[model samples]
Structures are given as structure tokens and as C-alpha cells.
Target chain A: MQDNYQQKILGIIGGGQLGRMVIQSAINYNIDIHILDPDENAPCRHICHDFSHGKLTDYDTVYAFGKGCDVITIEIENVNTEALEQLAKEGKKVFPQPEIIRLIQDKREQKQFYKENNIPTADFILTDSKADVLANADFLPAVNKLGKEGYDGRGVQVLKSEEDLDKAFEAPGLLEKLIDFDKEIAVIVSRNEHGELVAFPPVECAFHPTANLVEFLFAPAQISDEIGEEAIKVAKDVIIKLDMIGILAVEMFVTKSGEILVNEIAPRPHNSGHHTIEANFTSQFEQHLRAVMGMPLGNTGLRMPAAMVNLLGEDGFTGDAVVEGMDEAMKEKGIFIHLYGKKITKPFRKMGHVTILEENVEALKAKALKVKDSIKIKA
Target chain B: MQDNYQQKILGIIGGGQLGRMVIQSAINYNIDIHILDPDENAPCRHICHDFSHGKLTDYDTVYAFGKGCDVITIEIENVNTEALEQLAKEGKKVFPQPEIIRLIQDKREQKQFYKENNIPTADFILTDSKADVLANADFLPAVNKLGKEGYDGRGVQVLKSEEDLDKAFEAPGLLEKLIDFDKEIAVIVSRNEHGELVAFPPVECAFHPTANLVEFLFAPAQISDEIGEEAIKVAKDVIIKLDMIGILAVEMFVTKSGEILVNEIAPRPHNSGHHTIEANFTSQFEQHLRAVMGMPLGNTGLRMPAAMVNLLGEDGFTGDAVVEGMDEAMKEKGIFIHLYGKKITKPFRKMGHVTILEENVEALKAKALKVKDSIKIKA
Candidate 1:
């Protein structure tokens, strides 16, 4: 029998909602979690075993934090990869390998990697500035995306024609042909150091018109068996190709021509998989912990049909969060609400989410919509 | 819309594993949890929003703690009920009701409550001392229990005959007739202030030979439909009779003669219901939060057949805990491990638990046994 076992300490870079959820799962395994974030009042500050207030991109701060942990991971990708690479070289387990994080940190590199790897994706041309994008007017009706430091809907614009090109970014970016897709979906997959891989079923997503963020997600995406199988295969292939260890969310688009194309990917627990906390045997948070810890991946099977609705801050409201209709929304059965403990709400800020589970997909969808309308996060 | 919404703070009496798990659920709702416990290093010390290192049984400590919270509750029943009663009088919500907690604190009072309410229970006689028990030789083959401060297997002894009377407690206690039980089952019930009640399906429990604590629990107890319904009704009736608000665990014995009797009851989360974390749609922890918060009760439907095995410290081991076979145990599919963040291990101490879910009952039982035998906690 093992004797005098010492528990391993895990260090996370960002202490946002994702880190908060990951710490929730880590508590079950008796693992001590240390979080480093710039915000002193980060969502995970109070819950983690230790919280260090520091910038994630500061090399000295990141290296100092990694020095005290046996395993290092991240909740957000915008971190110092050089420090992580040094830590990995010193034998600390840094998941989603620092190299992969660097590749994903730049949207241009991500697109080029996809093309070089023969992955199915929309055609795109790298651009140095707005002038470069304008010169590619022949590639009109395209989407212009900044190469780095873009998040949510920021640093992105649609150049439907030459006139729309004026909205293009001045910094180095990319112009990709915009395809009219029938639907958007995401698949979350995880891999461990032992080469064990598991993928959750695809979830269809609907974006908010103004916020440009996922508004609703339906698990077991409404697609044929063949399409679902292909999606799973493609997700697995991407992870294997990256040679990465950790959870990766692969967002894809399905065109009217019945073709699937890669859109974007995140190397941590993604919003698209939040419903798994109540609808699947293994939640994405727990799965991420298992993958990074090199434990056996849990069963990623769905327990019930589910729909998730993002609880975003109401427009024109930015102050102490006041959650309305929580009591009324909770009166409905099969509804689980999760607030990020953010205290404050900004317009379109992701405040929390509500997950609805039902035997009938239609019922799940209807309940999800009702929940979205009933609850408002305002000042 | 809710305007200037103020979040409520919840105060808990104990900061052990139960409180830790409760905080895990409370975090999802963004509810601030404050804990009061004498142990400065309690498992919940790190996770709770606020923690006061003080005795739960101390009137002033509990009262002061409750005064700061909008709602107050307990993870253990040995707390100062007078303080809770005072809190309730001052318009604070003290769930499980102080009166009910006081009644269940003493074994004698609990037995009298069952008798007065016409609740089916094994025949028993009140005893004040060892001599009092010896005087009742005619009541041979009974069990003796202390009136108060007795927990786990302590202050309880089986009096198979007059010779066993010497083992009886010298303090005021009770003598209960021994039961030739076919199996032991427990049903957890919850009630909100609105008088809404819900009961989870009965679970069959197997006790450790020496520990006298539940070692294995199987959900959807293998009992007749009539017995299951009867057990559920009895559980609901007890909670309703107490006029209590929150979760109550009712332990019962099913005699070989096809009769069900109430054995004991706990006013908080019990070991018998830990499997619900993964096997049921709504976990007992979350259910308790909802009941006490006066939110709508969640669906307690079973998601899969499940078995839970408590991870007890090895009999001959003590000091820092060392968990062996965790890697092997995790290799099995459908297994969820929960390790209470206890740094030390003592003989028979509850260190953690493993839950196994399977489609087949036999497979679940086999897997549970394998997990129990495979994992070893030592110093």
C-alpha cells in the first residue's frame, strides 16, 4: 500500500469563471489549487487554496507561481508561454503544452496550422494591415480578424464588400472567406499523457445577435448519425494532431451543402460544455482535471437531453449585479442556475448560465428559452 | 425585475465534509457561506466565504455567527439549539428547525417522539444507568444507547442477554429491543417552508462488522414496491410531523417478518445518500440548499443504478493518510471518487468514498466490492 502520500498541488494561470469551476471539481480529489490572477477579487479568489494577485503575462510572476506547483494549467490561453516552457523543462506537468498555447494564441497561426495539417477549414489569407486587406478586394465578402489579443467579438469585423473593408483592422490580421453556414456546433475532447482520448457529443450553438456570444446551446446536436460521427472524428483528429494534453473545445460550422468546417478552438473548458455539469456522467471541468492529472478519462456519455442559456448582463447596465426572476425561474423543474460570483455586471458580460434537462428535446429547448427571458442580470 | 438585489448569506454550524460539499453547491448559486467550527483547520475553512473558528455547541459563538447570516443551518445536530431558536425568533431562517434538532439530539427523546407520533419502531424501554438496565432482565436481547453526545457507533451496545447488561451506559439512556432485520434501508426527505415535500428512493445499507457505520450503500433498495412506498411515506410523514424545513435522513430496519421500523434519524446530509451526487438528477447537497433557501425542489429521479463504498482508514494505520490503488480504482469506468480533505488518518475514520454506476445491479455490486477491496488508505 502507498504510505505517507503527499497530495499534488495544481497551479492555474487565470482565476476567472473557468478557474472557479475547475476548482469546484478539484476539491473532490483533495487537490490543493493555487490561482494567479490580476484581479484581487477574481471569481476563484475566495475558493482556491491560495490566490496570488499578479498578471498572467508577467514572466517572473508566472515562473514564480509555477515553481510552487507540481502540475501547471490554465483557465485562459492569454498567458506567458515562455515561463510555462521553462517550467515544463524543469519537469512540472504543463498541460495543453506551452507550444500549443503559443500556436493558438495567434489566430493567423491557428489558421495556417489548420491549412498545413490538411484540416478542413474556410480559405483565408494573412494580412499585415487594413491596406493589405483592401488590396485583397478580389477576396471580397470576407471576414477580417486580428491576429492576436482578440476575445469574444472584439478585434473582428465582416468585410461583406469593398465598402465594408474600411472597418478592417489596421494591425496584422487575416481575411477569410465568410461561408453561409446552416448551423454552428462545438465538440469538446480530452487527451491524457497515456494517449487516452475521449470526446463528448457535439452541441449546437446559437449566437446572440448583438453580443456575438453563444446565447443557447443544445446537447446531442440536431444532426444525422453520420454528421455526428464525423464531428467526433474531426475533434479527435485535431487533438491528436496538436499532440496536446488537456481539454480542447473545437467549434465547427455546418454549411447548407452538408460540409463541416473548423471555426475556432479553445484549450480549456469552454462555454459550449457547461451543460455537461448536470446532463452528462462526466462534466467538462472534471474531465479537464482528469486529463491534466493523467487520470483515466471519465465516461463522457450524456445522461439527459439538455439546453444551456447564457445569463449575460443586460444592455446599459453596469454596476453591482442584481439578479431578477431567480426565484421565479427556479420554480420550474429541471433547471440549474450557476452564477459566477462576479458581484458586478457589465453590458453583455457573461454573468452565469442556466441548464435545463428534459427527456424531450423540444421541452428542453422551450424551457431554456423561457429561462433566458425570465432572468436578467442588471444593476 | 429585481432592483438592487442583495444576495443572502448562509451560515453553517459545522465545517466538515458535509459543509464542504454544501459550499460546493452553494458556490453555484453565488450564495455566500459562513462556517462556524471549533476545528481551526476544518475542511471547509478554505472554501467558505467566511469562517469563524469557534465551538458550534457554544451559545455565544453560534448566535454571533447566525446574527451575521440571513439564513442559518447545521451539518451536525450536536450544536446549541437554544442559539438557533433565538435566531429563528429574530426572523432568521434556521432550517431543520431548532426544536426538531433538539428532539433528535437525544436518543431517548427521539424514541419517545416515534412512540408518541405512532411511528412504527422497534420496542424499547428507557434506562438511566447500568443497574437500571440490569433490573430489566426480562427485556433481554435488546440494545442500549446513551441519551446524548453519542455519535457513530459509540454509546451503543447490543444486549443479547442479561450478561450483556454490564456493557450498558451508566448515564441516562435507553434500551431498545434487538431487531432480526432482513436489511437496513434509509430514505432521505426534504421539506421547504411552503410545506412542499420530496423523498428520494430508499437505499439499502450494509454496515461494517466492527465500525457499525454504513460501509456500502445501494440506491433503489432491493425491496418490494409496497415496502419502498411505505418507507417513503413514513419518511415524509416524519418530516411533516416535525414541521421542519430542510433535509432529513430517516434510517429504518426492514425486519425478516416483512415489517419496517424506524431505527434512527439525522437532520442533515447522511452517509447513506452520498451516492446521489452522481446517481441521481439532484444531489442531496443541492437539494438541501434548495430546501433551506426556499427554492423549488429539484427532480430526485434516479439516473442510473449506483453503489457507494466508504473509504475508511485502515485499521492499523494512523497519521498522515496515504491512498493506495487510487490509480487502479480510477481506471474503472463510471466511478466517481470523493476524498474529504482530511490530512490525517485514524482507524475507521471516514476518509473518502467511491461511487460506482452501472446499468446492471450485479455489475454495480461487483464493481463496488472491487473498489472497496482495491483501495487502501494508510499512514
Candidate 2:
């Protein structure tokens, strides 16, 4: 509970856009941040107090890195849990705890964690391989997900028929019954070690039809206030059960029957809450740092209705990046664009995001699409 | 005016707190920032794309730094104007334009500019030295100001009597008739090359009795709507006459007779607008970059009623710095403290600031004083 990390060096395990954003907020409070990632060209290399290029999964590298820091957190969940556990034992604060991260790293274990905690999640069957999933066809028209190392809509596929099952990869996976949902929503919850919990407004996420990636997100979702409250309550329940000391983003599904089901959870600043940087009283990145640093959690009130669209690299671009139409996109008022400092533009890779804030929901929604259409990330 | 500075290098002279805050906003737009300052330990040294430890007033050093950047801006106005003028001739964009900086760099010329432009400022006479002012005696009970190289309440004195004149330093100065003012207010006006202008609400500023520096500021100045509107109009007129790109903060005095008079102006983000970071829709730091980058100006609406208190270094402490009562101060909701990354804290040095936001003005005023009482910046 002591403010040991105040103005001290805090190490982060991953140096992607999330880490980049956390550094952005940390600098405001004069907190020194060091980032560790496998790539030397990691997006966060520029802003952090120090950056070490080493595999986060390498036990020696993570353990050695943790030894020199007062606190350690992650932007990614694939870090060496054994090293984090060791660091925790050595009096280094590891946020979201290594055990929680260990559980969430694997799709099967994460689903089990939900069931064990009595959390509402979709009915899912854990399988060793595609053959096992094909043999048990009861969960047909389900979503097949990899057990580990999958992110950003990767390592997941919808199995609509036997032909879909045949397209499944030969790896351990989880077969989740795709619920008929009215909407996909997300709520970002921040909690400190003091048990203080704050939840951002529920956001409705619309995914691309084929890519299964969030196309755009709207805060204070178009759903009724009652549904938004229900979604938030569900998310808070999950965070309370997990008892994670950091930001926990709960992605949920609102069924036609009005039941809220947890789709998944990310124990760090999630894409759904990106709009918070511009639309909320306190940004999710700042909230995450506050939680892990044992500082008071800030107000999560929305300042205005905001719509966010992700800028993924165009299908063909694969080298040096060029963001076209940025000048035109920025001409609109209340529009903020954040480009992650990534040099290359690989197809479908997250290059940046644009947030549109407006008092009128319809107007903001229209502006969001126009922004999405105007900008293209290419090589 | 194209957005040529997008994802391009921006060279800023003087890497102090103002430059640091500007860099914080610049990072969001993916613009590369490089800073030139004499202090390698300056607040912006770490955050910028590149930092050159060199004399800002040296023509060769500044010209070299300008050559590598797409556009050059300034946090302090004392940089070599000749270097900037040369860069401008070579086709590099320099905000606030070196010609304007030349005129504002001297108090005598600045007052002359106000008179020439038909700006409503205090009546003043340019003096070659303090001896000239004493010999004339016409502007007794006036304010004596140095022509150049003065900042942060330095190089200015009140000459109330013959005894007060003896305390003045011998230098080329300006003698202005001191007017009895009801309140001191400032408005930050941002304008781009496209002539798009936006003005923040007038903020009332209170100066420290001894330091003569802003101690606290209130946004939307506790005045009637008419007075606030008149103050903003005056500020806009000054900015229009200056015709400078980037932000110009116009300081004004609301006299006892209800007439507003321009006090002075800073061609950069001024301290009185620090509360905008937490209380407004878009921060002044971000607005400055928008103007300099040729992007559309953002909304300048206030998000909440807010009060800001400056954090000057304790009167005695003069070594490495420490901010006491941060935990206690941060415990109060809506109280945001920003500490400049200053290793040493000398007496009356601008160390940082705290912003208190509340819907109720009375409650916020009370909370602001409590925050001011709680935190202490010491060495």
C-alpha cells in the first residue's frame, strides 16, 4: 500500500502501443518508465526512460529486468509468469499478478477461470487438436480459438459447418458456442490494491465482418441505459473476482434475451477504451498506471460521446509506412488521431486510431466513418 | 498551408517546462520534436526526438538545428532571431515568425508595437536608462521594466516614490503609468497560417506578493459575461494585430473603471493557462502544436470550472527536489498535480502546478487553497 513506486522506475514487459500509451501518461506524473520487448524497433522504445530488447518470455531476461525495478507491469500477457512470480516473491510489485496473467494467457484456462469464478461466459469445450473438435460435433457453428499466443483477431475462427471445421488448424484449441447476441460491448475497469474500483462507460464495439477486428467503438453505447448498467455490473463482477490490480477490460455480449455474457478479458489497457484518452475525465492508460502504482483511481466519467476507429494497414502494404489523407482527416474538429510509432506497415496491422467526439451520437457516428474512409495506412 | 510537419521534425528552442509540455502533446500527433537548450538536463531533453545541448542565442547553433527540421517553433522568445530569419529565407517554416519575435523581445519595442497597432495598453514612455526615468519624473508611481532578457517576474519593479526609484537597476527600461486594476486576466489565442483563430476563456490570475509571479489562476475569470467577452475580444484583437502563428497569451488588466487594458503578452503557452490541461476540451500545449503544424484548431470550451496554483520552489531549499504531501493532495478527487522534472529546486523557481476542478466554483476555490496548503516543493 505504500507509494514505493512514486517517481521511481517502473518496468513494463511489452513495448507495443499499450506500453507507449502508458508511458505517455506516466511522464505527466514524473514517473520513470522502462520497457522490455523482444524487438529493438518496439513502438515504445522512443518515449520510455529505458528500453531493453529481450524476449519477455525468456526467464533469465525477465527476472534480471525485474530485479532492477520497484514495480513491474505488462502491456502483453505472454511474459514469463515464473519470473514474475519470482519477482513478486522478491518484493517487486507485479500488477494483475503473475498468477492471473498465467490463467489469462491460455484460452482454455481463461475460460475455466470464468467458470470457476461463477462468471457468465459462453459454453466452451477445451480440446487438444482440430481432430478432437471435429469428433465432437455437438458444438458446431462455434468459434475455434488457440490456447495461447493469439491476439488482434488472430488464432480465432468461426466454424459454421463441417467445411469450417476442416479449415481449423492442428493445434490445441477451445470450441466456444457462438451466442446469438444483440450487441458486443466492452467495459474497462480499474482497481488498486486498496480495493478501489472504477468502471468506464460501457462501449459498443462493431467488428469488421470478415476480420473479426473491432471496426469502430462508441462510448455510452447506443444501447439503453439499463443495458449499459447491466454490462458494467457484469464487468465489475469479473474484475472483483479476478482481484487484479490494474486495468481489466471485459468484452461482453448482450444476447437477444438481454443476458450479458463475458466474451473475454484483457488485463491491461484494451482497444475498446482507446476513446477514453480524449472523451473521459481520465484516460485508461493513466488509470492503469494509477492502479498499479497504488495511487488514487481517477474519475471515470465521460466528458462527451466519442466514436473510435482503428487504422489497420491496407491489405497490400508491407514495408515503410505512409498514412495518406491525414491532412484531410485532421481538418475535422474534435477529431484526435494517435499514430503508434511503428515504422513498417504490414497488412492488417494496427498502425494508429482516430477518435471523434461530439455531443450528438448520430453526428459522431457519421464522422467516425468518414474518418475511417479518408485515411489509409500503406507502404 | 499543408501539414508538412506531420510526422516530421519540429525544432524547439529552450527545453524548459513549456517545451516539455509541448512535447507531451506533440507525441500524440506522431510529430518528431528536437530541442536545443543549454541545459542537457532540461525537462524536454529526454522526451524529444533529438536534443542538442547548445546556446539558443548562438546564430550558428540555432541555424544548424533549424536546417534539420521542417518547422521551428519556440518555447522561449530569446532565441537568435537572425538565425530564424535566415532559416525562413531558406524555406523552413518558423512559427511566430522571427520578425515578430524581434519586435516583442524588447519591452520598449513591444509597447511601441501596441501603440502603433492601436492596441489598448497602458500609456508608457521608453527610457534609455533608469536615470532618464528619474530625470523626467512624469511617470512617477509607475512600473519600470527592462527592455530585454527578463522573464518570470524578473526585471520589473514598481516605482511608487523617489525612494523606490533608487531600488531600480540601471538599464534601458520602459516607464508605464501604473493603473489601479480590479483583476489581472489572461487569454490564450491560437492562430494558424490559414488565419483560423481560437481563444480560451479569460482566466483571472493572482500574483504572489513577493515573487510577483502568478500564484493561482481561475478559469472563466469570476466576472460578468460582458467583462469576460470584452477581455477575450481584446485578446483576439492583439493576436490579430501580431498576426503570429502558434499560441499568444495576452495578459490584461480589468481596471476599477471597468475598462480592460492589455498588460503584456507572451508568444508561447503561458502559466495562467496551465489549468486548461485538465479543465478544457483541448489543452493550450496541444493547441500551440496544432497552429504551428497547420492543422485545424480545436475547441477551446471549458470542461469544468477549475482553479490552478503554481508550485514555486520553497524559499530556502536549493538542492535536489522533493514534493511533499503529494499523496495527501492526490487523495482529493479532481486534484491533478504536475511536477516539472526539475532535479534542483531553487527559491521562487517554477517547479510545477496543481489544477483543482469542480462544478461548484466555491467548493473548487476552497479545494484549490487546501491543495496549495498541502503540497510543498523542497530540496
Candidate 3:
């Protein structure tokens, strides 16, 4: 039988909303896909051409799932790297290859790699003993953060006073001074295997204040061109140093002097680039898969000035997540809502996001604020 | 079992590319779906959560497949209306409802309904016997079209000269004069169950001169405001008259005398509205689902000026299909490519389309022509 569709399958290791969205890109190219995830009802299952319901990290599941595809990719980072490495050794394409995945899986290795590569980062003392920094009275109270899997403010603590120092006893990790900055920002940069790289405009990050998850991202950065160039340069240099072959979203801190410092990196599509779906010519998820597959990247031009507001589960809400006022909220011009289709949600869990695209910055900001207030993810 | 993630299961009767595209919108809301089509590997099969492979016209299949859905709809016009009516009688929610489906299923009934409701359409005479038309002689050299299931230049014929008239001596249907059309345009007007209606920017269409199917659609239709308003009024009137609670694509022809006349109407997403995916604030497919499901209608504002060029298979190709130069065509700024995942090729088969978005009409038109010439669909 002759197979007519020319695009090869892009196998994704996790079938969450990220994978679901990645499949959206694959659909445009008529690319066949095989998805692996634990849930039979995983969001990605809806669109994946072929799906295997199993743990993403199960070595057999990951390896076998990869064998049939021309390239293997991932939506989440928790997949087992050893299994991926074995597959890569057998000539299956795994991007953000197992080699790179290995370097970024552990926070200790990730931070140390940055240090070894002479990348500018906050200086921290890494130790196996959590008591070392606190017991050393000479050591001023500093921030103690776990070197691995620190997500959504979990495993990270701000230690300012003497009394708060006891909290550091729980996480046996590194201690560094918390950088005082004006605003948080992130840049979604794409680098193909051949070294072609392009960066979307930096997005100004606004945290939830309480939840610590990025609540909103304002596009076009609203910063001077000089600062924008500096940010993109920093992101480009990070990609070059990491030898990244796909999209690497570089999150950073902007100092009072408008200097950008590297904060973290995500090998796949990042939440910060969500605005690109409706605001930019090419979405980050599409760019990541294209770059990894050695396919030509799309235009990253801005389609409109936009802002993205994440929808987290409201506190005390758990089952059968409901996006209230969504119908009413979406009536506003330029507002685009994306519900993740997750059934259950713990408090602060990412439920969805709403993007507003318009030309008038002030007017769009006003509407975005209204949309943020009107729409709620609750049971 | 209390279904946590379940919102509503929408069953679509046809599994063609339009149904495949509709699945995309339902995916956005994480809506469960059951698509019934005969092909085992139908393009819409995997994208839909639960798809039962069956023929739409089969009574048992149509009736059973729609039992579990909250509301049932269709992308194709040809289906068993009796089965749908039976389901509706049993309290199943079917949009374009059963009555509307029954009336539109046959050409004779459709023409009668249009005339009774004063809907402007081409003058026609419906006669099954070719002898009746020949005996009349006045209907000779007429535009003879099928009363059912005609699409994309198929099931339609134009009797131009005496040679054509003689061949029509054994034709199956009656005919009428071919009205010289000025400019063809389409209005994607959506109406919810609540009677709320919103019209997308009218799209001006140009035919292939040979294929008869729309070759391109220039959105933000470069016509006078009066003509645009008239198109919207016609579309809205059709929606109201049909009492169709979903999207309706009203195709019209502006005569050489500037008089607008209805050409045809599709009660579901139409090819002429494909440009809305990237150009409009709300895509027609999503809006269709929303409207039929009784959800609040969304904004239909144009995000940018867009032009869509269809991808039709060349006449000589007939095996496995391939589209060349896609990589280079979509690489240009403001160009968005959509592939229908069609494998087989025949003369004038609808393959896919490319939408170019730019504020400058001249620039967009130039890009559209280049896109049309650059990409070739062949077997």
C-alpha cells in the first residue's frame, strides 16, 4: 500500500493539554502521530492519530512508542531519560535529545551546567545537607531552593528572617540570595537543528501574587528596543550554549537597570509563549516540532499586540471544573479562550488561558482585566 | 457514573474534511464527539473522541450513532432525514433540526421552500423526466443542476449551445437559463438557538474559469458598504426563514446590473468561509458548534484582511496525492496553510487551502497568486 501523506509522525511522550496542542500543529501538516500518557481520557487523546494509554516514564512504553515514529518529542519533562537515550542510540530521533534531557532533568545538573558553561546566573552554594547554611550563623538568611523539579513555587522558599530559616531544613538544596528585580519576563526562542534561531518578542510576566504561577503575560515587552535586544541576545546565547535544537523558552529577571538574567529554561513549548497562538504568525508549539524534525520554521511575526491570562482553579474547587462566565467573557472583542478540558483540578492548577489581541494597548489592557475578573474556573 | 469531564457529545453525520475541521473546534472546548462515517480511517475518526464507522444514510447507523449525543449535526447535505426525524421524535436534539433536513434533502422540496419563503435564488423548473423539459423546449440550453447531493462542480451542468442542448435530450433533470453573474460572494452568518445572529466579513469569491468551484476568496470583501449590508440582510433572512439554529453559508451572485441573487446555501460550514480560521476573531466552525449548542455567539470581527486560495488536484493526477512547494509557500509572512489530509487525487478534488493575511489588499492578492502557482497538487 502506498502511503500518500508525506509528513512523518511526531510521537509525543505525554498526552496532556500540551500534547493536545502539539497535535493541533501536526494536524495542519497532515502528520500522523502516536501519543503516550497514563489517562485513557487524556486531553491529547482527543486529537492524537494513535494513542497508547500508559505511563510516559515507563521505559517499555516510552521505547516502544518511539520505535514507530520518525521523530520522538515530548510535552512534559518528567519522562525517563535513560529509556530515551537507549532509543536515541538505536537511531530514533528524540529531541531535546536524551543527551540534552539528561542535562536539564535535574536542577543540580542544570545549574551546574550553566556554571560550567560560564552562563550568568545567581551564585548559590549547593550542598547535600540542608542544615549547613542555617547552622553557619555567618551565612545570612538566603533563599533555599530544591535543585530539581521546583515548579509553581513548590520546593522554593524565600528565607528572610531568622525564624524563617527553620523552613530551609526541609529541602536539602542550594542557598542563594533572592534577586530583587522590577519585573519578571520570558522569551520563547526557536532553534532548528541546523542552528537557525528566532525569538518572539519578550513577554512581561505578571505573577498571581499569591499563587506564584505566571498569571498574565503582556506581549511586545513594553520595554525599550535596547532592552529587547539585550533580552533576545541573552536567550540566543543560552540556546547556543545549551546546543538546544528545538524551542527553548528562557525565563528571566529584569533588574532596575533593565539588565536581563537567566532564570530557567524549558526545552519544549512553554506557557509563556501561549500568546503566540493568537498573537503571532507562527505558534511556539508548531515551531518546536518543526525545528526538532528539521522542517522549515514558520514566520514568528507578531499578528497583533496581545496579552495572555492563565485560568487557574479557584480555591475550594475540585471536581468537574466549570469555566463560569466564559460565554459572557468571550463576547469582548479580541478575547480568545482556551479551556484545557481537565476534569478535576486542585487549587491553583492551570485550568486554561484567555488571550486578548488588539492594537490599542490601553484598551486591550482594560478588556483583559475585565476578562480576568469575569471568567472563573470553579466547580 | 458521574461523568466529570463530559460537557456534551456532538455527533456529526459526515466524516469528510469539513467534519474533520469541525472536530478542531469541539476539541477547543474539550467537547466529546461521535463521528459516523463509512471509511475506517476517515480523517475525522481519531480526532473525534468516539467515532462509529457507518454510513450516514443508513437508518440504523444514523439513529443509533446519535442516541448518546447531546445534540447531533452534520457537515454534508446528503443524509437520511427519516432516521434523524425518528431520533428527534425520540427526544434527541438534532440541529438544522429534522424538519429542515427533510426539506433540504431533495431539490424539489428545497426549491419549493425557497419560493414559498420568498428567498431569492436562480429561476428553476424541477422535472424528473427529460422528455418533459424537451417537450417544453423553452427550458433548452439551460443551467441544469441536480436536486440533491451536488457539490464542488459535481452534479451540476450548463447547457450552453445547441450541441449541449441535444445531448440534454436524455438528461435526468430540468434546466433554466444560465444567469450571467457579476461577482460571487459568500456570507457566513451564524444564528444560535436563542435567535442571536452574527455575520463574518463577507468573502468575495472568484471561480477557476474551468473548475467552477471557488478558486479564491478575498475577505473583508472589497465591495461597497451598501452591497455588504445587502448580503448580510439576505443571509440573516435565510437563517430566520429556515429557522436554522446554526451557521449558514449564503452564496450569492451580483448580476451585471448590480442586482444580488442567491446562488446556493450550505446549512453547515462552507469552503468559502475557511479564511475565518486565522482572519476572524471567531472561526466559523467553532461558531457553528456554539450556535447549534445554544451557547452565546462570539465576535465575528476580522483580525486581519485575509485571502484564501484553494488547492485543487490537477486533472491528470489520480493516485496518491502530493502538494509540492508547501514548505516554501508557508514560509512567507502572513501565510497560513491548511491541508485536508486527503490521500487520493482526482480532477478538481478539494485538497486544502492557503490563507494570506495582510492589511494591503494588493500585497495579499500578490501573495495569494504566488501561493496558487507555487504549490502543485499531484499524484
Query: DockQ of all candidates, in order?
Result: 0.58, 0.45, 0.49
User: For candidate 1 chain B, which ten residues in a row score worst on lDDT?
Assistant: B1-10
Model 2, residue B158: C-alpha shift (Å): 1.2
Candidate 3 lDDT over A1-379, as tens digits, reads 2223356777888888788777777777788889998988777866788889888778888888888887888887888888898888998878887877767666667778778887767667775666676674345556677866776667777777777877774455777657787778898888887678888889998888777688888998888888888888888888888877888888888888777777778888888999898899999978887788777778888888999988889899888777777776656678887877788877998888889898999887887888888878887
The alpha-carbon deviation from the true structure for residue B282 of candidate 1, after best TM-score superposition, in angstroms, is: 1.7
Best by DockQ: 1
Label model 3 with its docking quality class. Answer: acceptable
Evaluate model 1: give its lDDT.
0.90
Point to the candidate with the largest lDDT.
Answer: 1
TM-score of model 2, chain A? 0.98
lDDT minimum window of 10 residues, candidate 3 chain B = B165-174
Model 2 scores a C-alpha lDDT of: 0.88
Candidate 1: RMSD to truth: 1.9
Clash pairs, candidate 1, are none
What is the Å distance of residue B311 in model 2 from its true position?
1.8
* Candidate 3 per-residue C-alpha lDDT over B1-379 given as tens digits, one digit per residue, 9 for 90 to 100: 2222247778899887888888777777777778899888777877887889888889898888888787889988789888988888888778878778766666667767778988877787876765665565666557776666666776677777655645453434546557887789999898887778899878999988878899989998878899999989988998899988888898888778777788778889999989998999889998888887777788998888899999899889998788787777756788888888877878888888888999999999999999998888888
Q: Model 1, stretches more than 4 Å misplaced?
A: A1-6, B1-6
